[model samples]
Target: MAQQLDLVDFIAGLPMPAATAPQLNPLDLLPRRPKAWERLVAHVPAEDVRISVSPTWTRVVVEQLREDGCGDQLLGNGKIRSHDVPPDLIWPEPCRLILMTADSAARIHERWCLEEAPGAGMSSTFRFAQQQHADRTPVSQQLRLLAEEQS
Candidate 1:
């Protein structure tokens, strides 16, 4: 005849709840302010930069990003998730990119950033053609204007 199963062993094998629930971080609730925002605002105010929004892109403040749950993406890789952007943002021409950074004070700063295509400046003809077009202003020119305005 087999012996009866031990009650203590069975109870020990059962899952138990944690003594305390995970504590929420107070800082997480606070508005996220990356250092890049301050530098950008100092270097180029929001008004100075022209944001051409798209369904996948937008110009938003750190607070808005945090509120909209974009802090992780913005803080992690410095790249905003296209699908995460709000549907309300209207897309326009001449999109301006902003890079973010964090400072010692936990403040956020914004700065102008752009991505150039590979071999984009390889040919003078392309540059000349760009220069010939007066109707459309180049990104470099717009960036120069931002610098000039700050000075």
Candidate 2:
């Protein structure tokens, strides 16, 4: 005869669900600021630097402060580089300069999708929340304020 399985034993072996589901905020999904950002910003001349933050990356542009007398100098030129913001970094402060455009938000959502397991896209509710956040926040103005504060 086949061995009999106890129903109570099987039920006990299953994992227990949490009493309350944790709340999810869409802003929590945004990319974090890069490490050592303050040091980087401090070293560069504030007026010559332009930093733009998107959901996937942070772009730092340090323009040349002086033009060469020989006319060889590149106008409107500087070093341009991008930093990928990992998921573990902290939010707020430097991250206050968020790109609020739909293109940027879509890129962020795409990145989140790729980072997660296949077929695990972000929830519609969270997407809506993100849109609301983008709408209410004047991020570009905040960026200017943050830059001023840093300087």
Candidate 3:
């Protein structure tokens, strides 16, 4: 009987629980809304791809593409707009959007890895070997050749 009373006393000494604060919608705490570009950056179409590379290799990659005759397909850096892509070209598995910064590239790497579509990407770092060769050609001659090619 004494042990039972001790248990009852212990139970009686415990405080009753209080209610939690009322739930608030998470959106209520937002400081501001996102801009249109900010929203757009979070998503990219599967058909389009992003290539994140250092500026040094970026030039090399662009030059390589130009030599390969895909220069017109290279749109200056931005999300791939429908008008920007060439209608004549058909992308294989994982075609990349051009010229993503290192930071943007990391985010894209993460997103693509999660999707298990690694082939759908390219990084200029992979092409750094192109820069290793010593070119004996003069800058002026290179420029002249580039101009001739453009014409």
Per-residue lDDT tens digits for candidate 2, residues 1-151, read 9988899998999999878745444434554434443333334332222123223322332111121111111112332244444444332112122333334444544433211111111111122322223342343344344334434
How high is the lDDT of residue 35 in model 3? 47
lDDT of 3 by residue, 1-151 (tens): 4545588788999997998766433222211223433353334343333333443333322211211223223223332223333444333233333443444333333223211123223333211111222242342243334334333
**TM-score order of candidates, top first:** 3, 2, 1
Off-target runs (Cα >4 Å) in candidate 3 are 1-52, 55-96, 114-151
Error of 3 at 140 (Å): 40
Candidate 3's TM-score reads 0.24
**Winning candidate number (TM-score):** 3
Write the residue-wise lDDT of candidate 1 on 78-141 in tens digits: 4433334454443222222233221211121111222222121211111111112233335454
Judge candidate 3 at residue 62 and give its lDDT: 28
Q: lDDT order of candidates, best first?
A: 3, 2, 1
> CA RMSD for every model?
18.5, 16.3, 16.5
- The better-scoring model by TM-score among 1 and 2 is 2
Residue 9 C-alpha lDDT in model 1 = 94
Q: For model 2, state the Cα shift of residue 24 in Å.
A: 2.6
Report lDDT per candidate: 0.31, 0.33, 0.33
TM-score for each prediction?
A: 0.20, 0.23, 0.24
Candidate 2 local distance difference test against the native: 0.33
